[model samples]
Each structure stands twice: as structure tokens, then as C-alpha cells.
Target: MRSAKLESMIPAIDVRNLKKSYLPINRRAGGKTIALKGIDLTIKSGEFYGLLGPNGAGKTTTIGIITGLVRLDEGSVSVMGKDIISDYRFTRSKIGVSPQELTVDWFFTIERLLYFQAGYYGIRKEEVSDRIEQLLKKFGLYKKRNSKIRELSGGMKRRFQIVKALVHDPEILILDEPTAGIDVELRHMLWDYLRQLHKEGKTILLTTHYIDEAELLCERVGIINEGTIVVEGKPSELIQSLGKGSIEVYLSDCDPEKEALISGFSYVLEPYDGGSRLVFSVDEPEKSLSEIIKALSSNGCHIHEVKITKSSLEDVFISLTGRAIND
Candidate 1:
């Protein structure tokens, strides 16, 4: 293992020209399916980064490759400045992954399962018992410590999965849809817990279907599409660059000349409510609003009401991918 002081100077995870593909199970189905197409990504230590993409966009494949669950056809991956392949045990020890699927043993009790997981990382029960108790209490799972895995609720199981991942106290935490299929309260709880973990200097790589979650939690985000990363930046920066804000103006009367003049602006104008309203997609609505109002007033067009909408992370995702995040 590298020294903590030395590891802090390098990136938590780095990938270069990553490429992966899966062979067809049946000959008649088709040729090999490409999962990742030469993607490059880097995550800094103690940063909360989000990896977002639609289904079949290679998000899962990328996570799998980094965690060593799926092999990459071509690429180089390093964790804490060490090659993942050459330093498999060291790199794996540095990361704690909570996958979307439930892969725990059904028969084991919650506490027992955690003990077994700790042992896998060469941790003795005596050395990890305090950490296990702390995690269980922090995640609200201490009450059910004696419950079997099969007896836990969905939310409880999700919490246990996170606890299991943290049993070894890895530096990097990779969470794949950590809040999916859970209630709103539980989801918010997990979000808070993740934030706490981030504060504690955990390098978190999150993949979530919820764009709002990514926007709220991630300091920076990368959106993948069709095996490639289309965009990567701060969520606000991405929204400002790739997303469009809108201004909807309701008019007192419809006039062809005024509408034609408004359409000449750089914004894309779409008529709403049979010309009674105009929806303009503008790059900067706040800067353009007064100009638009003045233009309308000078043209003798009466304004009834106005509504402005700022761009969001979801809008950026749609603009880049041409589809919703869930699609």
C-alpha cells in the first residue's frame, strides 16, 4: 500500500482510453456488442463525482471494469497512482463498491455478514467490531443487527449494503444507484449520509438515474452516451454551456409583425396557446428579458404575464443525449 501522504497528491482514480465489448451469447443474435468506446475519466481525491447516462450507455460496464468485476478489452486504469491490474489487491483494497444488485448471502445475519466481509479484506473481527458498530448505528441498522439478510426491508438492505462496503474503510467509495427503489425519506437519508462521507474525505464516484440527485450532490459530473463520455464538468457549468433557459411571455393580442420581429432574435421562438403566448429558448434569459420586453413594448405589443425558467442538469443531459436519463 502506498503512503497516505503520497496518495493524497495523486488522483483517486484515473482511466485512459478505456474500451470494452461483450461477445454475443448466441451466433444468430448479432456481432459483439460494444460497451465502452475509448473513454477517459479521472476523479480527484475527496471529490464527489457523478457518472450519469441512459440505460445501455456503458455506465455499469465502466463501474464493473474499475471494480474488476468486468474485464476491459483495452485501457489503463489506476487507483491512487497504482495500476489496477498490476496492483490488483492493493487497488481493490483502496475501493469499496456498493453495486446496484443485492449480492449478499441470504442466510447470514446482518452482523455476521459484515464480519465475513471484513475477514475477506484480512481484517480480524476484534479489529473491525467497533467500525461495524459505528456504521450500523450511523445507518440506522443497529436495531436490526441480529436480523437475517432475508428479513431486512428494502431500505434496510440498501443501508446494510453501504455498511458492508464500508466495513474495510476503503478510501474510495463507488456507489451504483445507491438510492434507487427506495422511499423518498430513505433516499434523503442516504443523501445526507453520502454527504457526511464526502466530508470525511471519502472519494465518491456515484452513478444515479436521478439527475436531480446528481445535481444536488455531485461537485462535478460526466454524462456518457453510447459508450462515450459526451460531456464532463461542474453541473452548473454544464447547464450554462449546454442547456437553454426559456422565457414564456403571454401577450394581450396576437400580431404577425411583432412575432416575426421577435423570431429574428437568436432565440428559437415557439408559439403557445395559438400565438397568445410566445416561448423563447434563450441562452441567457436574465440578460435578454429586458431587451425582449422593450422590443415588445416598442412594437405596441401588450405583455400580460411572463415566466422564466432556468436550465437544469436534466436539460443538459437531454440536449447532449437527445433522450431522458432513464431512456
Candidate 2:
């Protein structure tokens, strides 16, 4: 530990050149399907961090390793200044994990599930009862306390999983797509609860496909692709680092000639007039719009509407990794 002060202190989660590989099938390949390749990251205490990547991009593998569900072939993980392997009990005790898989015991009622989870953390009987009540209310699962796991809706069950993970009030929280399949209202409600927890000084690491969620909730974000980090920084910082500000042009008519003109510029890439829209980007839109309009007019086309939008977390992810966040 360096210092307790917020300015200089140990991170809640630290991963150093972490690597995990699936064993190769005989006669198929020389090496394994490396799930992680030297992933190095540090998430400060009390920070809301996002882990983002496309499918099979190692997001879940990284989560499994940190939560002790999957063993890593190399590298180290630390939670709250304790090495995960050497201080396994203490490290595990300090962290809460809600995995993506739905594995609830069908027979366990909501209340019993949370109560048993609390007992696993050695919470006293009285305190366990008190905490379960509070968690149920916080997650909007209070009304379903007596309901069996199989009886709860998907959203309610998701909330129960979160409440179960938080039975111990762990200092760190890991949520893997906690809002997936949830309606907008429930998703926002869950976001509010997570925000409140973060305000109470809980470090959070979340993996989500929702770009807007990542942009709104995460202070810092790490984007991994092909088992390596392509970008890591404050969300705003990463967004501002994009080369071209995105521009979407809606037209009353199609014009390939004008679209080609815009695409010729090294800065205005991904230009396509497919399906009745000329969409592209410009490094300096304010200065280049006039030139673009001229080119369009020369091809007997006119812009019906043009909008310059700021880069989003999704944009930054694609710009860095060359793939959409959900891909």
C-alpha cells in the first residue's frame, strides 16, 4: 500500500500481464486458443471501470480469472493490495462477482439464497437478516422474497444475483452484463443502484454491450481486442482521441460520385452511399463541409441533412480495435 489518500494509493484491482489459454486439441494446432495475452490493467479504488470487447475477445475469461472460476496460465491479480493466489481468502472476501451465467438453484427462495450467501461470508445471523432485507429493497426484489428462483422474472432474477453477490458488502463489485435483456427502466434503475454503491466508495468493474451505459457510468474504460488492451483511459479522454469526428449525411437522393470524393480523403474514411445515405467523417468538418457540398452539387446531388456528432465509447472502440463493441 502506498498511501490511504485518494491521490496516491493502491488500486482495488490490479492485473499484471495476465494471460489465459485454452489447451489445444490434439492434431489441431501447435499452440492453444489464447484467451488472454498479456493483459495489464489497474482499476483505482472507488472508480467505475468498464471492460469492453467483442464476443470471444477475452472479457469473460478475464472475469473468470479474477473471480477464481477460471485458472490463468500466467500473470497476477490483486484485490485491495492482496495477491489473489497468496491471499486467496482475503482477496476473495473483498470482492463480489455476478457472473453472466444464470445458475440459480431452482428450489431456493430469494430470501434463502441471499441469507445463505451471507452465511458463506460468515455474517452473523442477526446481521444477515438485516442485510438481506436491505439488499432486497435496494434491488426491487423485496416483494419476491418468498418466490422461488424459477418463479422470478428474468429481470428480478438478475437483481437477486446482484443482491446475492453483495451479501457481504464487499469493497469491490464485478458485474458481467448485469443489464442484459433488462428493460430500459430496470436497466436505469440498476444503474442508479450501482451509482449509489460507487458513491459509497465501492470499486466497480463492469462488462456491458450497451455503449450508452459505458459512456454514462464508467469514469475510465479499458477496451480489449484479440486478448490485448487497445485503449485505456478516461471515457472522455478516449472519445476525444478519435482521429475523425463522425459525420452522418442524410440525402433526398443517392450520389456515388460525391461519396467517392469524400472517401478519397485519408481522414474521411468509411464513406459509403449505401441505401440512400452518404456517411463519412471529416477531420475538420467545419472547414470541409463547404467543399463537400460543392462536390455533391457537382454530381447533381444536394444534402438533405448533415449532422456532426461527437465520438462515443463505441466509436472509440471501433476506431481502436477495427470492430464494433458487440461484434
Candidate 3:
């Protein structure tokens, strides 16, 4: 069950009672905008951990606090056992962060920018060139070495940022929505590269609104909302916690009054039939599916298809919050 195959390693990241707040000019008289509310989390050595949340869920705030971009109002953060505040330089040297925003100079080419970033990290002059070339090729940016920042596409720019962050060879990497807004093929390529990185013993913390991506790449994930940690565990575990049973029923046709009859059924907590498809949520999947099929048949409803699927993380989130619509 171990996703990371490293041997005899120590935890690369740790956080305790992490908290942050922001003050706004138009805030309530004495209340501060809570960004992180007492988060206690950890990432074992070489682990692929994901932080999943919707926009405004404080994913950025947590990364900002850990990387020293924002000041912390309470609690502590550490990377590779170095205190982020007290041993600031040492802590930062062991961590790399690829921000969600695209930040670059229009005039600089990919090669020059990467060299500059490595120089800023105090990497030896003799060692920088080889490392830069290797990273560029690995991320498929070698041909674009001389291309200006503005000339590259969105996916290329994201790959460039990742290369720059990794130039210093940090033990832990924090990626904020690395594949956001990119094409399907580019996303797959990026995913392949990240999987390689994870296999090479580099711990990663990923935050993305793309639920399916998180489900694929993350061995375990932490979900947060409204400045609070709602759930933390492996993706499968959280989904299983919701329930063992779920069913989706597709119908060939339906009547206007059929909606009311299906809605009044005791087994149905959630039901939807947009003329052709009728999805159902039930605690006892097998029993409910049978009853639903019988009722539909008795009422002259023709079911075109019926299938059963376990509750996924998306279902868990929606079930917990009772959300009508979501990402």
C-alpha cells in the first residue's frame, strides 16, 4: 500500500496548529478574515499529498504561510525539520514552490531565466549549467531554451516555472494547480513528469480544483473549506466513508407525475431524471436498485440502463455539505 518506495528516509514536511488571518478595511468591527483555522497536517518523506478545495478555500494561504510569502498570526511550519520562521534560510533551501500565477519577465528566454533562478539560490556556478540542461530536457522544454517567456504557450510557461522551482533541488515541492487551464495532452504530459518526480523520492504537495486530477495523482488528500479542515485521508477512504452503496438508473422515458412518485420513495435521498437519465442515491444500494426498478416497471417506466457505482470523493463532499451544484 505504500505509494512512495523510498528506503530509510525521514519526513520531509511537518505542520502544527497552523493558523493565518487577514485584516480588511471593511471587515466587521473586531473580526479578522480567517484564512487558515488551526490546521494540523503532515507529509511523510517522499509522499504525494494533495490539498483539494474549491476557490477561496485557503489553499493559497496555507502554501503562502509555509513558504514565508505571508506572515503567520499563530502556530508553526517546518520543512525538512527546519523551522520556517526561525531557520528561514535553511527551511526555504529545502523547499520549492511553483505558484499558481504565471510570473515571468517577457524579455528573458527560458535558459537565462532558469540560470538566474539557480543563481539566486546560491547554486555553484560550475554545477548550474548541467542541471539546467537536464531539467529542460526532462520537462520537454529543451527546444524552447532560447524562446522568450511571452512567446511560450500557457502549458510551456507552467513547465518553465516548474523547472525554475526545481533548479535548486529541494526535497519538498509545492505545486499550486500546475495543470490548470492547459490542453488535455499537455495535462497528461505534465502528469507523467510529476509521477516521475514522485518516484524519484521528491515529496509533493498539490492544490487543485480539478477533482479528477487529484483523484489520480494523490495517494492521500486533505479537503478544507471555510478556513477549516473538513476531511483528511486517502481519496478512497473518504469516498468509502460516505457509504458502500450508490446506484444510477437511466430511463428510456418518464411522465411528469413520475417525478413525484420517485421523490416520495423512502430509499431516495437524491434523485434526478432529465428525461433520459434518472440518478439515485441510497444507503442500501442493492435493495434500493431493486425497488426502484420494480416501481418504475409497475408504473410503466422503461429503464434503458441501470448501473451501480461506489460513492467517490465528489459525492462525499457534496453529501457532507448538501451542495446543489459544484466544481
In terms of lDDT, which candidate is strongest?
Answer: 1
TM-score of each: 0.86, 0.80, 0.79
Instruction: Encode model 3's per-residue lDDT on 1-327: one tens digit a residue.
Output: 253444324467777888888897776676788888888888888899998887777889999988999998888888777789999989898889899998969777889888888888888667899999999998888999999988888888999989988999998899998988889999999889889999998999999877778889998898878677788899877876664565766665556255655764543423355555555666656667777787787777777778887666777667655551144
**C-alpha lDDT values of all predictions:** 0.90, 0.81, 0.81
Tens-digit per-residue lDDT, 203-264, candidate 1: 99999999999999999999999999999999988988888898888876647354555754
- CA displacement after TM-score superposition, residue 73 of candidate 1 (Å): 1.3
Q: In lDDT terms, how accurate is model 2?
A: 0.81
Better-scoring candidate (TM-score), 2 or 3: 2
What's each prediction's clash count?
Answer: 0, 0, 0
- Which residue pairs in candidate 2 collide? none
Clashing pairs in 3: none
**Candidates sorted by TM-score, best first:** 1, 2, 3
- On lDDT, who's better, 1 or 3? 1
Error at 136, model 2, angstroms: 0.9
- The residue-level lDDT of candidate 3 at 59 comes to 89
Which runs in model 1 stand beyond 4 Å of their true positions? 1-6, 27-30, 250-280, 286-304
